[model samples]
Target: MASESSPSDPAAWLALLDWRRQISALYARVRELRDSDPPAAHALWQAERNRLFRAHSQSPLLPEARADFVSLPCWPYDPALAFSAPVEFLPLERLDIPSSTGQAMPLVRFGRVELPVGTLDVYWIDVYGGGVFLPFRDAGSGHESYGGGRYLLDTAKSADLGSAPGGALVLDFNFAFHPSCFYDPRWSCPLAPPRNVLDVAVRAGERAS
Candidate 1:
């Protein structure tokens, strides 16, 4: 763990703040352009992510990995894999999910979303300034994607893709990404729970490199 006097501590916090700001801005543009040109919006998203991974101070890649980084191993953008799914509200049930930091995060199961392939529980951080959280593991996990899983919406850090006119959450699998913990264990991230694991292979997101 980094100490308060460690030079990298402050820089890491500031870099993470900047990273969140950039991510929110990127998603804002995605919401605007996704309707008119899905492919172009996807391209913009991928290019910006590549830039962040390669150049951003808050990147999860190690020094050696960043030195030779080119692009994330991702499946091609497929429109069919994207959807605006309606939320099915459930009786609020609370659970604590273990994190990579060895601490548990309090989460409330507020709803569930049914995709064409399977269903996923939608959670809300049961803490101050709550934000929606949705993480899932597919059949490809441990082989094609991270063994723990990937995140679709972690609004606490401003990783949101926006909502539809009918109030459905815009879930674009092409934009799905591995958590920071996937690359570096220094970061604390919540892993997907048992109910959120899907039986189908979701082949349109970031893959193991």
Candidate 2:
């Protein structure tokens, strides 16, 4: 049976709400820039990026943006490495996951799932002109989110980002991971496609406490 949780808990409930708020803010900022202005979108993206790397959502009073960028957690990534090539590269063409909703790239068995998995190539972060980053999740929904078992897609290593070469974008579910919410709820994360949902426990990455 299911039991109720407290809204005042220093951990569980409060953490959940805090996570929602961070995601909400990230989503809100992104929403405002959809068609507003590319430049504005870029700026907001940078700010959101700052929040993701730096400060987290205040768990107590639903905190507000503190110091210009001081209160924020400094991004661990180096701007110079944003365009660096991945250590290694591989090609994928199929993703094996659930996708009754959007487009699904087929793939062979991923993670512990004896079955195949599918990947949705919607949000691709262009790390460099030759490589792109695609974050995703799989069967392990709540068990392991922060790690969510994600992987990167690179063009320098694989075929071109386009359909010119023999590179496929099929993602590996074994790498599914959790979002910033796992470490700190002061961050927003994208939702995993329904097709990506798994019915079993994914014992990788950070677990909810």
Candidate 3:
């Protein structure tokens, strides 16, 4: 953990800034590949993600876990889980929700997507440089996957899966992944709210090992 004085230290601040830049670049590359070839893109994403978990300075895994870390267990890419749902724009309604960090972040309900399995509300974070946030929980929770939920798209942190024609957003459940908090308790992440919870078992994403 960084000390209290680390934030004020020039070297530490620069290092953190560099880390953010690297992560942004990594996500950008993933988006580019996803637009071209989704399967290949996902494969690359998994590989790069594993690399980050093993070698990145800001890996979420504890030191002891990192030594034995290989790759995150994920279900095979399933095309059935992919969808290009139309976005139903919602009224400008904002809600303040508590985060794992114990801070309440304001989020605006921007749209709703109706998938074959169910419907999910989309939210836009009400903050500077805000972006789309989509978290979902399924029956697999507490067993195969994280008990809290998995994030599908959090564009603010650059986990975009791409979009379809007519402004429909592409949501590929096979790309769903666990938040950092899943690996490290010290990290705090938002879980799937009531509206985002799905009764169906979405067995095509990252799972607990």
**Candidate 3 residue-wise lDDT, 82-161, digit = tens:** 88888899887899766566656778888899998788999997788888988888878889899888988888777887
The predicted structure with the larger TM-score, 1 or 3, is 1
In order, what lDDT does every prediction score?
0.86, 0.35, 0.80
The local lDDT score (0 to 100) that residue 197 gets in candidate 2 is 48
Q: Kindly report which residue pairs in candidate 3 clash with one another.
A: none
Compared with the true structure, model 1 gives a TM-score of: 0.93
Give the per-residue lDDT digits (tens) of candidate 1, residues 1-209: 10122335667777777988998899889879988998888888889999999999878788789998999999988999999899999999999987766678899999999999799999998878789999999999999999889988888777788999889999998888898888887777888899999999999879997
Q: Which stretches of candidate 2 lie above 4 Å from their native place?
A: 1-115, 118-139, 144-165, 200-209
Each prediction's TM-score versus the true structure: 0.93, 0.29, 0.89
How much lDDT does candidate 1 score? Answer: 0.86
**Distance from true position, residue 94, model 2, in Å?**
22
Q: After superposition, how far is residue 166 of candidate 1 from its true place, in Å?
A: 1.4
